[model samples]
Target chain A: MELNKEEKAMASGELGEAVKWAINHQIKVGNFFDAKNFVSVSNVHMMIDPESVGIDGVLFLENLVGMGAKVKIPMITDPRGVDLNYYTPLGQTEEMANIERRTIKACTSMGILMTNTCVNYQTIMAPIFGEHVAYGDTGVVIYSNSVCGARSNYEGGPSALAAGLTGRTPRYGLHLEEKRIPTKKFLVKFKPEELTDWGLLGALIGKISGSYWEVPIIEGINHNPKSDELKHFGASMASYGSIPLFHMIGTTPEAKNYSSKFLNRLDDHIITLDDIISLKSQFGKKGDKIDVVVFAAPQLSIFEMQKVAELCIDKSFKVPVIICTSPQVYSDASRMKLIDQIEKTGAKVLEGTCFYNQYAREIGLANGWKRLMSNSAKIVNILGGYGYEPSLSSMENCIASAVAGEIV
Target chain B: MKTLLKCHIGIGKKVQGEVLSANDNFSARYDLDRLKGIFSRPQHKLVGKSYVDKILVLNESKGGVASAWMLYEMCARKMAPKAILFNKANTILAQGASLANLTICDRFIDGDITSLLSSGQRVTVDPMNGLVSIL
Candidate 1:
């Protein structure tokens, strides 16, 4: 990897130990991917969730903070593992909360903003067209890359933290221009009427695309998808495929730029209603009692909060209903009494945390929540491995199921 | 008998360990029971098996970015695979391997690493040389 004079200085430990470590780390990853040079990123987002971070990652961050490491550019975080205020009831141990606190303190010392969101594209400043960023969270990367036309690989916590420190990442993967071209083409023949439908479609595309290297170009979607709908779609796609970027021929920016060449062949995979239904059928059936109803994967946007709240109005839940949202949207929803309305129906709204990252396995065992039902296709796919019998459905159906205590 | 499988040069120091090959995709956040150092995901082929110190040969890395940090945490606890060889690895796994300083090689010229090595095979993974020798 080619480095400028300043990067050389950082590499030589003249800049600082943290910067040196950061640059060296980038060099190794850059070289592995055969990156030509480092690209300066506009911002960075990291996921330092406690369950993932544990003791070592916390200590690692603290070591950097002790060495006086500070982010060169704006840096935010993805959803944390433990929502400190509401952990105990949710089965998160004090050990987990302490790790979260230490991690937050270390990150704060290094000038990272604890945005605690997976929906940062919706809540925080959405990255602009062609803006390179080092973002953690698969959902964030896929959304920013596909919807917002930003360029980012799916940086894990350590890599994004390194980018935060150096203000640059090894220019490889999605940062490279030629790699963004459509690898597989999909023609969407079925209508994605609900958010879950969008999620299911995205998941099917991702599964078929398979490897992280294959970027699927999608077509034949007649409707303009809302932000939350695309959120589920992109999140579920990334969740299923480990894919970083995708192109929706008409909707996304880069897809539009390369629309002529990209859409020439759209017969790689033809998606139909039967294909999506086949995938959905594997989840669960109606009348299967659910342990809980959740409205998150990519945390809810403010608009989604309103929709959830409206559904919760003058209603009651027979089973637990958990909704996760970003702090920004949570505050706004709180001010609008959307939180109150949702909570009135015995639903719990956790701010600054997504359900999957929140010690999900432990919480499930503690609450005996084996039959998990969620509107997000991403969550259902994830919880299956975490010892939960996850079922998928639409948001309206999820709410209905919570009221009836079954998959309605 | 020893046979060498050439792969793309990958991250971390060379390591030698018993092989645990599975055709399934991997995600520490998804398939692992870290506390017990076992594959806990029911759908995974290696479910119920301990992965600690073994060379985990999988089809590819899939799902979630948390594996990046979890790799380091698991290594810190000595509960991680000694190395991971995928037919194709994702950006997250590479980044995680760098942080954990764990050996991970992918894109074998020999093709289909899972078929090349089975569970309980002893192998030496030389990531810098992009070669894995089945011993």
Candidate 2:
């Protein structure tokens, strides 16, 4: 891979050991993908939760800090593994919390902002069209690339951290223009009315696309979808398929720009209501008792909090209801008394942490939560692997079932 | 007789281990129980199987960024695959292998890696030269 003068300086250890290591890591990854050169990215978002990072990764971060590393551009974080204020009740150990503390201290020493969000596009600044970024979370990458018209690959924790230190990433994969063109075309025959429907549609498309390299161009949506709708759509797609970028022919920005040529060489398929129902039917028993109800995965926006709060009013749940939201939205939700309304009925609102990444397995064992029902398709897909019999439903249905202690 | 398969140059030191081949996608967060060192996802083909000290041959990387860190954490506890081999690896697996110094190679010039190697077969992986030899 060709390096610029600045990159060469970093690679040569002139900028310090951390930058040198960062540059070398980027070079290795670049060479793997046959990157021609490095592209300067505008920002970096890292996913380094304590459960994932462990002591070894924390020690690694501390080592970088000791080497005098600081981020070159704006840097942020994904949701933490342990919510410091609320971990104990949720069954997270002190050892896990300590690891989280150490990781945060190390990251802060390196100048990273504790944004603590997967919904950064919704809560933090959304990257502008054609802007390059090093973002870790799959949901964030897909949303930035498809919805915001930005460019990024699904940068993992180490790679995103490296980009934060170096301010650039390998100029391959999604950064290259040719890779963004549509490979498969889908005609949506049914218009989705709710968030879960959109999520199912995205999940179907993602499963069919099934690779990071396959880009799907979607058509046949007559109405403009809102930000929250696209958030669930992209998050579930990325979760199920590892898809980084997609185009909605008449909806998304880049799709509008390339609408004329987007369909030329693409294989066509049609998505119907029955197709989505078949996918949804794989999750739940119609009237099985549920242990818990959750609303998370791509942590809820303030608008979603409002909707959840509306459903929770004057209603009490027999099973535990967990609501995870970004701190940015949490503050606003708290101020507006949305949190109180939701919590009034025995629901707990966890700030700055998504459920699956926050030691889902241990928490399930601690709470005896075997049957989990959630509105997020992404969460349902994830929790299945973590010892939960996860069920998928709409927000309204999830709330209703939580009250009845069964899948209603 | 030794059969060698060539792939794109990959990460980590050369190592030899028993092969555990599966046609399923991988993600440390989604499909693994790191504490137990086994494939924990019930739907996965390798469910309930221990991956420790073996060459994990899988279809591709899937889901989340947590795998990048989880690989390093798993390696720290001495409970990780000896190496990972994929038909086509995504950035997360490659980046994770780089951090953990775990051997990983993909993009075989030969056909499907899962079909090329069978479970319990001893193989030597030379990541620098992208060669896997059935021993």
Candidate 3:
């Protein structure tokens, strides 16, 4: 909080006015209760849309580009819509369309990749396990922190860039090795045969902890889950709560080495089967049937799509179905002709857009989607934005509700 | 004591511009965007909107460079608030100036918020009624 003489002198003149003004208007980074000195950085990841645009934000993007601050590091950009040039389901105003196009062009001129897709993880810069990197994706943040054993704070665009520029983040909280240790414990009663229901488990944990960053060591569940299942559950953890980290008792890179005796905090908070069942109950009204189904608020991966495909081949749907996937996955699936077969049935394969941004609005349900089903917890949270009640269920259940057109 | 602290931060070679001002703390956990369910919400809102040509961002480096970059891009399109001013060059502002390709003049002054007191809300260093408060 102390400024040296050089900075102190600038505070009096017009020059001071500019610096003081710039720092106060950006996105909220962390709890702020524990933030220490700010580090300047470049080549950060930013998410932008008109609706969420702020006065300072508009100026910030313009100034940076004009200043040529974006020349280095790869820029991973996500546009407001499923596609860069198209309107949202509600349609973009002429002004909105014009400005967005300009913004994308400005970024690209600075050498940004301009993916314009939310699923940057599927793109070129996916972070590996234990790779300390800054990211802005809410769902991806949860996935990397919990499932991948990587390190990152819940940084938005600005902070992400700062971290990238300095290549060093504040070495406190989750960044500290001790902080990553598990504190809570849960005993699983049954082994999950199919991993689609991992989100249910995450939802149950999210309620128990009430905040992100808490570590839960899960026990029980005899089956070894695939990578996809962990990803599904991690997305749910981030969706339901702000949880950035968690661990399985017998798995995870760090946990595997410890003889299950490591502890930074005690395993005081424990969950059981009854507790998980209670989670299922929370997913819906006491007994209201589902009316529609959506999957992939974070954009599903190929592994997740394959699970759905298998389920579809064995059974038939009874309601309207929508599943979202990253463009990369869609492309690969299309090459294999999976897109043709999936759409042939009742389901629609939406590319580039996630369910969180597209579907509910297209249906004219601004903030009131009736009984919805989702395989990911993040989708459930987005549904909550519109007053749509959601049921956390398996991939099969999501498809079933989609086909049924109502919760059965 | 309202402390009005300002610092002169030198711009990176790629940065440009002067100073402008805004009223809200857009990203301190709650805002119109995050509240409205918009992902990748705009950290600053001066783009293509009605405002002075050059701006002095009275905000935080919480959004880092991208936050500043967004504002910088707006200026590059002639839609920005003009120039920028800051209390001190934190990493966020440095990145902002770098990303926006705008020249920044940073200064540091220590006084109560009342000293800079004409009118405003939620400044990075606010000396209100002669009281210095850093939010």
TM-score of chain A of each: 0.98, 0.98, 0.78
Give model 1 RMSD, 1 decimal: 1.3
The DockQ scores of all candidates, in the order shown, are: 0.88, 0.83, 0.05
Poorest lDDT segment (10 consecutive residues) of candidate 3 chain A: A24-33
For A116-151, candidate 3 gives per-residue lDDT tens digits of 555666554566676775555555666666666777
Q: Model 1, residue A382: what's the lDDT?
A: 91
DockQ agreement of candidate 2 with the native complex:
0.83
Q: What docking class should model 2 receive?
A: high
Clash pairs, candidate 1, are: none
- The better-scoring model by DockQ among 1 and 2 is 1
Clashing pairs in 2: none
Window of ten residues with lowest summed lDDT in model 2 chain B: B1-10
lDDT of model 2, residue A13: 99
- Per-residue C-alpha lDDT of model 2 across residues B111-134, encoded as one tens digit per residue: 999989999999999999999999
Clashes of each: 0, 0, 142
Residue A387 error, candidate 1, Å = 0.7
What lDDT score is found at residue A84 in candidate 1? 87
Is 1 or 2 the stronger prediction by lDDT?
A: 2
